[model samples]
Target chain A: MTLETTLAAIGPADEQAMAAARELQGRLTKPAGSLGVLEELSVRLAGLAGTCPPPMPEPAAIAVFAGDHGVHAQGVTPWPQEVTAQMVANFIAGGATINAFARQVDASIMVVDVGVKIPLHGGENLLEANIRRGTHDLAVTAAMSEDEALTAIQVGLSVAGALVEGGAKCLLTGDMGIANTTPAAALVAAFTGASPADVTGRGTGVDDETYERKIDVITKALALHEPDPAQPITTLAAVGGLEHAALAGFILGAASYRVPVIIDGVIAASAALVAAALAPNSVAAMVAGHRSAEPGASVALANLGLTPLLDLGLRLGEGTGAALALPLVASSVRVLREVATFDSAGVSEK
Target chain B: MTLETTLAAIGPADEQAMAAARELQGRLTKPAGSLGVLEELSVRLAGLAGTCPPPMPEPAAIAVFAGDHGVHAQGVTPWPQEVTAQMVANFIAGGATINAFARQVDASIMVVDVGVKIPLHGGENLLEANIRRGTHDLAVTAAMSEDEALTAIQVGLSVAGALVEGGAKCLLTGDMGIANTTPAAALVAAFTGASPADVTGRGTGVDDETYERKIDVITKALALHEPDPAQPITTLAAVGGLEHAALAGFILGAASYRVPVIIDGVIAASAALVAAALAPNSVAAMVAGHRSAEPGASVALANLGLTPLLDLGLRLGEGTGAALALPLVASSVRVLREVATFDSAGVSEK
Candidate 1:
């Protein structure tokens, strides 16, 4: 489906289903609201599915969208741009941190090369959906043209549709792009109208000099583009990476399909800002997996009004945090579906 | 083992192993310290196990120690005391929230009747290890004689030993006691030097009048007992519930066996305070599962210097929160064990 169609299909969560879920939650053996955020999560998911006790978010799939940032030349990060392709290879070879997490949680992995600078060959679980060799340096010019940004988003959108059609009940976002956090900070600043200094963070453990340089790079990008939050696609085109555009599409696709999508760290959070701007109701389908250690993640998540499930100080963007949260997400729904009511269990209420 | 023997067997975790684990974490494929709290968790586990990459904390066993509080008569909670016995039956019958969560995480449940006011019959997964009918109301007098408290603790010790002997690698704490949070608050106040007004919270959703009365009850208990924090046994016997005493012994037992124990809500946190006091090194074996919405839990955990794994506003005290955290605890160790080193993965570092 086209991006416009996907955007149009997305709507607000079903309030009736949420009401039914809240009622059901009250009757469950546990005290009303004792399950805490899990209770709210289950209700939100029910609303997303338009039914109480939404389908078990099992058979989870993670799409690791990879790209390269022309901002690498700005000395914004310490890692070489080639590391993006290398890590994608690590993910496909089942040797990356995300792979280990997916294996632990029993989720499938899909690696999409949306804009890696290096030419990546076919391998298991690899999807060649590269939009370009790499984005233009955001500090000098728009990261990508409007057409390229839209095409990359379509890549994310189609990937989500394909994963759901293949029977994935839940979708997770993963990202792998060297120096991508630079663009992520730029995107966050553009969408949230926050200062670049406040939103920029040292990605992949940059030294003090590189971290300051990273902040400088983001400030320059924002000043050069003057992106508007009202125009999400144009803002994304100005400051976002190929993978960021795709992730926005992926989120929209998940919302259009009425499935819960777990957002990763800063990259996914920036993408989510775009998706929420495009379709405000898409926020209903978004689940913040964890609070990234990256400072910008908190800013972006606060703007989106999302509470993360885990806060293990994780800054890895390869969906590792999201994968770790899958079991918690699944348990929230399973409690709604499986736990007996006080009446059914013959347990006295307060 | 006797309580003295168990205490003697427990010591500080292996610092050498912790150092080795820290060194190993630096070589992992992910950026240094990117895993955040997870890296620290893995290192702690290694120290507990006396080796790098500690044994996977799989085959987890949750011990739901059920008791009744004479405080029920003091109107600290709205739930009937008999509900404690009913919930034990539900736990044994696999119909409770803890049972559902245990099933979700593939952990086994063991419901122990430590000191229910009502006599409970045998059922699947039920252990009749009762020390008495229940504790006296702390607001009126000491909750239990020193002897009764020690015997109750032995019940937890033996249960933990049995579970570990039966091939369980990780232990989780659960509690089912009507009005138990009353004693929990009292214990926290005693151990942490916090005031009743600061530590007390509405258990199972009490009304405004009942909440004020509950705080008054706790304040009266602390004033009467004058419990000393240094003498954990005396403090626990004065204001703790039978389940809280058992949970303390259970935590000590896990520490003695070198297995991690995931502490649940306020009840378990208060008990953990006792355990940590008795054996200061026992903190090494403790993992705070989640910060309960109950106000006292934070006070108790803060005194123990433990940062909880999840903070979902949970108040249910049947090991539900710990069970939800089991996967995350396991994944921390799994990442340490499975994720390849940068050298092994042929990935360039920054």
Candidate 2:
């Protein structure tokens, strides 16, 4: 499928799905009408799949897409590009915050290894992957070669299809890349028309000098391609990383499969922006886990009409934030499935 | 117990509780640690209750203390005190937003006429209560007689006992009182040391003239009470509402039972200030449902160190906001209870 069509594939919340969630919510043992938006969410899921309980979104999949940004060579972040690959290993091994949270929530983690300039040999633990082995550096060229960008999205789509085929009923989107915040900031600016100042923020607690440099890199990259907002993937190409492309596709694949997707932090949110522009209704498939300290994240969420659940000053990327939100989503589903409705409980209502 | 001691009866989160939440979060089905705060909250609840799944806070009792401030006559609000009783009926009839959300979440709703001027009979749906049928005009005297204030709190405690006996694992607090915002504003200001201008906001959508008038009433009331922020409930007796006092006691009672209390909006959060002073740990039991549009609400939350979940432009008073947060709580519990651990999933961890 074409990249543009992939993100654009999601449709509005299905009425039948909502009815199913409401039906299950009505049957739960507690008060008939107590699980509220949770009921709405479950029923929407039900309608999406045209089934009750929406299959529990079981064997959930987290697509941790990794890629490098060209801007990092100019020193926007203190960390080196190798850290992205290192963190991906950290994610696969369950040492990172996302790994900890994923373990806590019981979600299965998939390290896409979407792009890392360093070739990943098939280590038994690490998923050997490379969408053109990272993007072309944005400082000198568009972040990714056009074919590489498409391949990166295909990698994400492949992960989504595999997860679905492997029985994952839900997908969680995560991203890892050094200096990703620069591209995320630029993407937010392009999509929302926010000033670079408004969308750029201290990434990894960067000092003022580094932050300004990051902004400069983003602004210069934006100027170079002047990526059209109307063509989102291309916009992602202008300043996006391989992970951004994969995440945008991963979100779309989940939407296409009629399963829910929970988005983490600014990097994932930036991808979500591109995804949403691709598919207006795909926003429904998304549940924003938390608002990160990253400036671009909130800009993307607001533009996408999402409200995050937590705000505990989290900046750790990976699928961790999304994993954290799993309970809230599961609660929405559980309340729908377990809470009793007015008629079942014989409770008097106005 | 002395009023101070009675208020001080509530306690903060103990170490055991936090640890329990963390461990339980590790076992839930979706991922090792995906649910985030929902997982944390559930496990914390388990530790607090000394159980694995923790009680589902069912048969939930909501205390909606309805009252009126004499300050309304000063033209601070465009609405009359009678609206308080009318809204009470709205709450009882399931016609309000709180009702919709509460019905969705399954918490039982009870209306307490703590200080309404009108004589309303209690039904099966209503909790028969009235703190001297409304307080003295705070524009001139102490908001209510000290005896009246104590009785109002006793009313809250009684509600807690009844709900607990009825099998509730949590106490949800809410309030409805006209021009009551003035007293709440005073209480919040006294505790937070915020200027009246910063803490006072339009209640029920007042015009600028009434807004200024509302601020003046609170500032004048603060002058009369000269409340010491260090002692909150005593400050409540001097300048707050009857319902506020009752809600404070109710919060303490729930904490004393180790039952989590979900504090609704500004009114409840304001009451939480008094509860916090009464029982320094009372703040531990609360879940701020939403940050209200009221200026004092955020100040109160900040002082109490709370973070609310919803921000849907709701400033309406009722346990509705808190009630809506219940499913989130439920979702947390389910994750802690249902999701499998790393050992079971056979997923290698870092």
For each candidate, report its DockQ versus the true two-chain complex.
0.82, 0.06
The CA lDDT of each predicted structure is: 0.92, 0.73
Output per-candidate TM-scores for chain A, rounded to 2 decimals.
0.99, 0.91
- Cα deviation at A104, candidate 1, in Å, is 1.5
- Cα lDDT tens digits for candidate 2, B215-315: 88888888887889786646787888888988987887787778888888778888888878767776667777777778898899999887776654455
TM-score of each: 0.98, 0.67
Give the interface RMSD values of the models in order: 0.8, 10.2
Candidate 1, residues B166-232, lDDT tens digits: the string is: 9999999999999999999999999999999889998789999999999999888888989999988
DockQ of 1: 0.82
Provide the TM-score of the second chain in candidate 2: 0.92
Put down candidate 2 lDDT per residue, A246-275, tens digits, no spaces: 888888888877788888899989888887
Instruction: Work out how many backbone clashes candidate 1 has.
Output: 0
Tens digits of per-residue lDDT, candidate 1, A1-350, equal 99989999998999999999999999998889889899999999999999988999999999999999888889888787888988888888888889888988899999999999999878989999988999998889999999999999999999999999999999999999998998898888988888988998877888899888888888877888889999998999999999999999999999999999999999999999999999999999999999998888999999999999999889889998899899999999998889999999899987
Report the poorest 10 consecutive residues by lDDT, candidate 2 chain A.
A28-37
Q: Give the RMSD in angstroms, all C-alphas superposed, for model 2.
A: 8.2
